[model samples]
Target: MDVRSSAVTIPAGNADLPADLLVPAEPVGVVLFAHGSGSSRHSPRNVAVAHALNEGGLGTVLVDLLTPDEDEVDSVTAELRFDIGLLAGRLAGIVDWLAAERPVGGAPIGLFGASTGAAAALVAAAQRPDLVHAVVSRGGRPDLAGAALGQVRAPTLLLVGDLDEEVIALNQQALGQLTAPAELRLIPGATHLFEEPGTLEQVAEAAAGWFHDHLHPQPARA
Candidate 1:
């Protein structure tokens, strides 16, 4: 696929967030990555996953949930990262902007999130069921999403490291509460970051497969 990458500063309330937009020449769908707590659009793991998804013919948008000044304050207060409502609103605003600006061909749009960002993704998906087609989380803190978990209607996938026992338990608990079709995958011998050799690749593969299966258009037979 021919992929083009660009940067945009999207208007968000009183601030502008720098976002990296990757659009495929023939897009199957689009994914928006919501980075985890203390992470940004610069996160290598999220970038890796976005690259993998691009290879699968999906456009990706990775946006900074906070502007530089807001992030600076969040570093000390930790207030912005944990506020699911605020983060979800930002994600929703970005999605709304993309819906109007992009030529998506009615293709599926999904949320790919890590850690606390997963909660935000869930909340956003819940709020915009008509626009969001799927949701995926890695090493996520879905429990932090609270009541928003019940409102999610998209097909949701949760991926966790096998040895990360606490997170696996949290995912399982959240999975039970979710109203949507959901599945949990445990990658063995992997830690929270999936830093073990080949683990992140597996994570990417699983994510790509899920997005492809859920987002891709059916081929027209010759």
Candidate 2:
């Protein structure tokens, strides 16, 4: 499969966020990566997952949600990362930009988020019910999405590490609040980052499958 990779700048609100886009020939869909706080578009785990998604006929956009100046302040204050509303707004703007622009324009959209980014992704899905079709969260704080959990119409998959007990409980609580089609799967022996051997690969495989199933166009019912 021929794949084109490029660095693009996305305008979200007042920020010109940098992103890495990968599109294969005849992609089935495009998934946007929302990284955890302190992580950028270069997050190794997310990059790994994106690569897997690409091989499975999916396009991917790995974007930094914060500008350089904001990152500097966030690094020092550690407060911006927890600002779920701000992050969700920026993600929604990116979704709009992706829909209107480029090599993957008009492709079905999905979101893959990790850590706090998951909360942002959930809220963004709620904000754009018609555009976002699926969401996958990895070791995330979906509970942080608050009341938006009930508003997300997209099908959701929550991947939590079995070793990360606290997060699993939190995800369970959030899962109950979600009215959309959703499921919580546990990765054995993995911690918050899925740093255990072969655990991250499991996450990548599960995420790729979920997006493939949800993002594809269904056949017309007779």
Candidate 3:
């Protein structure tokens, strides 16, 4: 499949975030990535996952959630990254932009969020219930999404590292609060970063399968 990859600026809230957009020919869906704290669009982990999704015929948008200035402030104070409401509003704005712009030409939209960004993704999904089709969280802090978890209508998949017991527990609690179709999967022998050999590969495979199933669902038999 021929893939078009480009650097684009996306308007989210009051900021214009830099993003990398990759769309394969005749994509099944488009997934927007929300990276974790202190991470940008250049995150190696997310880049790897995006590559897998693209190979699976899904378009991907990897955007920096914070502006350069905001990132500088966040680096110093470590506050903005944890500000779930602000991050969620920006993500919602990006969703609106994607919907109106049709960069992927009407492909179903999904979100892949990491760390605190997962909370923002859930909140954005709740805010745009009719637009976001599916969500996947990796080593995510979904509990930070608070009441938005119950409001989210999109099918959500929570992937946690089994060795990261605290996050696994948090994901389990969030899983129970979710009112939509949801599942919690543990990556064995992995920690929060999934840095162990072959572990990140597992994350990519699982995420691709989840998006493919929900974003490109087959028509029901008559």
Candidate 4:
């Protein structure tokens, strides 16, 4: 199955953010990614997971929340990373655009987020409950989602590395705060980035499985 890929640039708050879209010949669901702080859409780990999802018949969009100029500044200031409201607003705009332009037809939409990006994803999910079906956070800092945590209705999966003890505790707290059906899976032997050998594959599988479970097929008639 050859997947067709395209480069899309969406207007994000007066700037154009580059995105790479991968869709199967026949897509089953769509997973939009929110890259971690200091990590662009070019992050190899997220790209690898997106490839795996494409192979599993899912469509993927790896988008940069910040333009190159803003990213450069944030790379040093770390201010943009914590601006959950701003990032979430941009994500919601993209979601609305994709919903209008794509052939997804109310197909379940899932968010795959990493690091501080997870907080943005959560806020977007809370704001657009009608469109977002599920969410998966990979080594995410969901604690930054703030009060939005209690507003999320979509099923969510939080994956963290066992060796990332601090994050594991944070995710545990986020799990308790989430009003949605949610679970926390700690990948043994993995660190905050899941750089450990074979751990990323585990992250990919867990994400794909979570999307599969939460994105329901339109009601089937007997």
Model 1 pairs in collision: none
Q: What's the residue-level lDDT of 12 in candidate 1?
A: 59
Clashes of each: 0, 0, 0, 0
Off by over 4 Å in 4: 103-106, 217-222
Encode model 4's per-residue lDDT on 111-174: one tens digit a residue.
9999988999999999989889999999999999999999999999999999999999999999
lDDT of each: 0.88, 0.94, 0.93, 0.89
Instruction: Compare candidates 3 and 4 on TM-score and give the better one.
Output: 3
lDDT tens digits by residue: candidate 3, 36-113: 988989999999999989999999999988999999999999999999999999999999998888898878899999
Model 2: pairs clashing at backbone N, Cα or C within 3 Å: none
TM-score of each: 0.94, 0.96, 0.96, 0.94
* Model 1 bad stretches (over 4 Å): 103-106, 216-222
Q: List the candidate 2 regions with Cα displacement exceeding 4 Å.
A: 218-222
lDDT of 3: 0.93
